[model samples]
Target: MAPIKNGRLLFNEVPTGYPIPGRTTVYDGSGTIDVESEPLNGSILVKTLVLSVDPYLRGKMRAPEAKSYNPPFALGEPLYSHGVGKVVRSEHANFKPGDYVYGSLLYAEYFVPKDVSYLQVLVRPEPSLPWSVYIGAAGMPGQTAYYGWKAYSKAKAGETVFVSTAAGPVGSMVVQLAKQDGCKVIASAGSDEKVKFAKEIGADVAFNYKTTNTEEVLAKEGPIDIYWDNVGGSTLDAVLGNVAPFARIIICGYISQYNGEEPYGIKNMRQVLTNRVAINGVLVFDHHARYEEEFYKVVPKKLATGEFKYSEDITRGLDKGGEAILEVQKGTNTAKKVIVVAND
Candidate 1:
């Protein structure tokens, strides 16, 4: 095994506002990964590679009193997120020294997780696909779209499904999944390039919401049966206004309001009652039990058969992790923005 060291992204103090500048402290491998070298009888030591920088992570950076779910990133401590890595050492009976794994970890090169019950060990490494896909298509975003489609929206063939943030990891998958179900998919992206990518991924209609008014475009597009909302705010309000009766609005995320000081309000929620629409907020972790069964069972099969497609925008280093995360929120990334911790 390679020599273990301490490497991490650290913050001095939590930010109180937006456009956070160079507050991150980057530590190259230099210290012990854990206080104890031996796993607590059932733990594994993973060497992290790719780390995910998601929009929701911004919420975690705020003061704990500000929100729920995940707590604030501790001042002067290593930040953490979902990452793909290899098991360099293991004491757990289920894992071996050379096995590959993917799970939550501190933003460090090596992670000694005492409780790896939640971590998944990769059985087959596919050379055809990049390891980063485990963070996208075969990872959280994929599961988000998959379970969101099957459980909440229950998208049907010949229906018109509208998706916001259509070029993102989850949004792109929703677009392709809806298309494969024989639904006419309309997607809204933040830029022309993202719109083009959405169309390339099989969205029947793709529009840049930054240029065209969402309400105006949806008005011309007519009523939609399903609304897969990733960017809430005005886009969701517009979608609510144009939704068909018995439509399903999947509340995947609210990226637009993530950075705002004041909460953005939606003015058209009455449509939920008037149109008998069903709106559901989804968290991918809620469906962890069926993750492998669903991804490997359905999504991969479709991808292999050319029925689904996905794209990623990878940042080369952990030093750029914060920048990559900010870029996604700013809609600067055309696809899933991931930070590659190690190439090999």
Candidate 2:
């Protein structure tokens, strides 16, 4: 067979408002790596299987650069995301062809490694397990959920826990963990379908925040003990006013304010002061000590049994990444959004 030519999703423009697919993101260009040639020293050639489209990447798309934890994607550079792939060629000692790996890579169908020292060759999951799980549940999103929820929320059994945006990758996992840990989980999503999906995944009560009055709903749900804060706009304000004393508010994400167009003002600082709620932000890397327990012992067992379920809204082909990201940015994606480059 001939060598495969690869297409790439490039960051074409930085948007002050919401990202426009074809304008801010362009997918017209491609680059081909001749398989006949060699990869760099210790570089591995990988055929992309799954590419993660996370909300955080939208922040990175800006060029002038916000004061962020990660750098902005350079203009004309291919958009990069968390990706899982199979090694097609390797120039390293530890990696070999046919091994599965996951790391940050461009939205290209294949890797042309010049400086990818951060890539890791992963061990294959069970034959029955879907390889795409590495890009979602067993990957960064899940890790973010697991560590973030446990580390900050410190939720106890029989506690009333409320999670906003409960249908997202991290939020959905947070819902299940709170439920399985014996907490009474009350979750909300922007859409009705997302609210239903949250209920299906172990939330005791799930409501469409767009349709339901958030304050009225929480007023009935009573004094939430833990608020796994995902959307940090008016929702955070509502949680702050409605939570119990000493409640823990875990700041995992702020999907509502990502586009930087409509900045929400939080006016309920007095509630936090009176109630003594703890608001803590989480980064998945800060809790790496639990990685072994989660990857090896916990998550696999939960997956093997019927105790856990994860949803992935997989868009096919690398060309669709631009549109998929736009969907993610607008609070429309109901599941973990990943681009399926190839799934064998």
Candidate 3:
């Protein structure tokens, strides 16, 4: 068999703003993997299938020494993050060709993992849910949404929960999950179309935040008992003022502030004090001890019963990864951004 032709996107220069195309990162058009060569007992080579292009990746595109939950993407090296791939060659005892897997892998057509620490064999494949979904709503994002809200919000039946970015992969799932939990849901989106989409997915009331006054809307919606925030700029400020006493605020992501040189300062943080709000910032990795147990026990059941539905905004090639990242950061992608790097 011929060695595989490997193509991958490498982090190039750091971007001070929206990562400029081909400037911050560039796709290495072609390279190779010696499929004919011997492999270590634990090594597995995978052909990339689907990759998730998420906003959090933006924060990671910094100098290698920069501090964060994830180490920075080393310059001129292959970019890596949550993606789904299929094992084509394996020396690993547990993996075999035709097995679909998910992990923190490079955005490459083909590659070998440095170790198995970050990869997991997919127990279930797609068609029931597209294989790409392992990188979308049913994947990391879904787990993040489910765990984040459940862990912090303490949502009870008859209470109301408000979520921002309600049409996004994680936020969209939050709407349905909260409703399924018997919590009344109020959701907000950037556009009118997204507003309707949020409702179609289960938001009790969905509003276009761009045109509406958030403070007024929340006031009319009544005192929100929990805020499942996906964006943490002015909306966080507004919700601060309208929340009920002892309301829970789950900090999921601040997409609104991710690209900003200067953050939108919250004017109502004082409310966090006086309103007795419980604000907790959640990073998915922080809760990995419970990942396998929580994810398999929850998402699979919801998925099987037709109770879970999500959308993906796909970019169709390994080379298009850069464009997909920009689409997500700029809030232009219509749904969850998953890059289709290869056929499953």
Candidate 4:
């Protein structure tokens, strides 16, 4: 294929209840994708390989004042999320041509990053793992799990740890990491198939939350010492009811409430006070200053030792991006759902 001097760009015009015409689209554009690109400043042109489709992106699509980790996605602009891309050109000294990097890039074949500071250079070229793994296990979700567990819960050996959305990118890593730390892990997913995959990855106990009563199933498993909460709403409430004395609950992502008209409320806040439990909300970007410090110390070491593992649900093309997003939100994808924008 010849060089893409100009290519199609996909953007979201408005939030929708489901995937529909006005919600997403592809259009043609031209001109240099410099850091000073109009509405998006500090942009850097990138040849995207894999675009990450995450539940968090849905939250970002809400109206501006919704108060998420970042501001809401601008109307009539390309939607952005964590992705792996090749730097085809660079106006920033930290990034150069031919460098394979991972960061927040637009959901397009190419991107001109506004704030390239979020972008990190990918050092491992001949990766023993697939490139998509970096976006899931070794990338953002991996960091989310690692720091959340270490900082908030401090999960230890022999403790009963329960993880919700346990088959997705962050939850899957949390299970393996907890196991590596000698914790007995109980995981909850949307389906029986994902429940099995959760076990295959290291979960001592896995349940299909869609079919089982989370409280009843967890009751048989005994009290949980640590709760890695990826799905909030009823799941969060259930975990609160079953938490052991002095337990730690790490609130990662509320995938359960992301698409809802109103956020889910927990009727069990009193449990935190009664059980002496520590419930902390985690945003990975808040710990950004220590990203390099933590990444080098934790991720690379475990990856080399074969202690960390990850999985992805790959969608074939940009046209399929909307489908991938829907799949993730509906809890259909077993792992990290990634849209392949450009393979080569």
Candidate 5:
């Protein structure tokens, strides 16, 4: 077997604030893998197809000594995240050649995972959507939205719901789900295009948070009964001021604070007390057992039939890996940001 070229995005340095592209994470394209001969040893050899670049990966880019929910990225190894791939070879009985799988895969052209527990065989729908959806709308982000809404939002008909970063994977799903539940959904996005997309997907009202005043929007459309928060900063503080009594707040991500040196301090603590708001943070990994099967059954079918709409911002090739993560971190991405490493 001849050595085929392999490129990987390596965690080069720990960033003090926003990560610098070749300095913080370096793309090394000089490596090679002999696909036919690479040792599997109860592992699966995956020829990476597409990688999911997410905001959460930014939090894991810290120094190894730092303690967090997920471990820090190794200084010189390939960065890993949710991805869809084709199995080239397998030593494990559960997976075999040509199986398309999705899970925590490396940001490289090829990978042989030391652990296979995180990987699962992808369930392709009857009328197929793009494989990227598995990592975007129908994967981790989708499940996060589904489980959080089911477990925490406690939304009822005609209740006003506000979702921050509402054009994003998780936020967009929350908007659509809330609408389907007969809730009046107000969505906020970083750009006008995203705001438009949010409205297109069933938001009763959608606004550009960057240009529109968050406090004013919430004041008009809320007494918010449910708030699905993605960007946790001033927007969250403004939400505190406008929440209905007994409002349920789901803290999905603090994307605004991930790249910052310090966390944003919310000044409206009294609002929480006065409103009797119940705040809970959702980490999707924690609730997968409760929601994974149901999500796969429902969301994928809706997506295929156009009962639900999803937007993905895909950057072609592994070479764009560094820029893809940067797009997600900076909120430059209009929707779910996915890097397509190869065609299936």
Candidate 6:
């Protein structure tokens, strides 16, 4: 068999602020894969299909010594994210050729993993959906929303819930879940188009933070009982000022500070003590063992039935991986940003 060219996105240089395309990451098409003859050792050879472009990756673009939950990207090596791929060859008992899988995958068209401990064979509840959905809606982001809401947000009926970045994968799912639980949902997004999408997905009051006053809207709507803070910074300050007594605050992410020149300091943090708020930081990785099986069983059916709306802003080709992630870091993406390496 002929050797096939492999395309890869390498973490070139670590960035102080927002990562630059050619400077921080580079495309390397110099490698080739001989599918039939390449040594697999004990790893599976996967053909990357879809990769997620998430803001959390920005924290990973730092010095290796900087302590964090995830390891920093090794300079000159392929970047990785929660991705869906097809197993091309396997030397592991758990994987086999033609099996669809989901896990932390490299930013390459083809590669053999050094570790397969975290990989799982994808068994979709609704097999008709696109494989990219597994990386976005029914994958990490959705899992984050489900686990956080169920674990930290003890939202009751008639409570007011505010979700920032409501058009995003996590926030959007939060909006839908809150609405289903009989809460009055208020959602904020960066654009008017996103605001409309939030309303379409069941937000009772959707506002564009860029155009409208967040505090004003929350005041007019009601004191928020549950706040899903995705974009932190000014939004957190605003929500702090507007929360109801004993409000539950889920700190899933702080995307606004991920690439900002200076970190945002909350000015209304005193509201936390005043309202007796319960602030809980939820990391999806922590709850995966407890909730992932249920998430797969539940979310996919709602998504397939059109009862739950999930959107993906896709960029085709592995070469565009750098640009795709930059879109997510800048909050310029309308929905979940996903890079498609190949069609399944």
> Model 1 misses residue 248 by how many Å?
0.8
Task: Please identify which of the two predictions, 3 or 5, would achieve the higher TM-score against the true structure.
Answer: 5
The digit string of per-residue lDDT tens for model 2 on 1-344 reads 46657788888999877888889898854577666464556777878888999888878878664688878988887888888888888888767888877788777777756666667777755445576777777778888888887678787899999988788888888898998889999999888889888989999889998888989988999689998887798988888888899988999888788887588889987888798988899877678686646554577557657587888788898788888999889878868888998876
Assess every candidate by TM-score: 0.91, 0.95, 0.94, 0.88, 0.98, 0.98
> By descending lDDT, how would the candidates be arranged?
6, 5, 3, 2, 1, 4
Question: Which of 3 and 4 is ahead in lDDT?
Answer: 3
Model 6 steric clash pairs: none
Count the clashes in each prediction.
2, 0, 0, 4, 0, 0
lDDT of 2 at 56: 86
lDDT by residue for model 4 over 1-344, one digit each (tens)?
Answer: 33443344455554555434335544444533432232323445688888778878777766786675567877667777888899776767888888988888776676677678778888763367667777777777888887787778777789999999888888988898899889999999998888988988899889898788899977889598999888778888888888799999888887766665476788988988999999899988777576647665678557656767666788876666666777887887867887777774
Model 6 error, position 103 (Å): 0.3
Candidate 3 clashes between residue pairs 3 or more apart in a chain or in different chains = none
Candidate that scores best on lDDT: 6
**All candidates in order of TM-score, best leading:** 6, 5, 2, 3, 1, 4
- In terms of TM-score, how similar is model 5 to the real structure? 0.98
Could you tell me the TM-score of candidate 4? 0.88
Shift of residue 96 alpha carbon in model 5, Å: 0.8
Candidate 5: how large is its RMSD?
A: 1.0
Off by over 4 Å in 4: 1-9, 16-44
State residue 202's C-alpha deviation in candidate 2, in Å: 1.3
State the lDDT of candidate 6 residue by residue for 41-143, as single tens digits: 9899999999999889998898899899978999999999999999999999999999998999999999899999768999888987888888888999999
Q: Which stretches of candidate 5 lie over 4 Å from their true place?
A: none
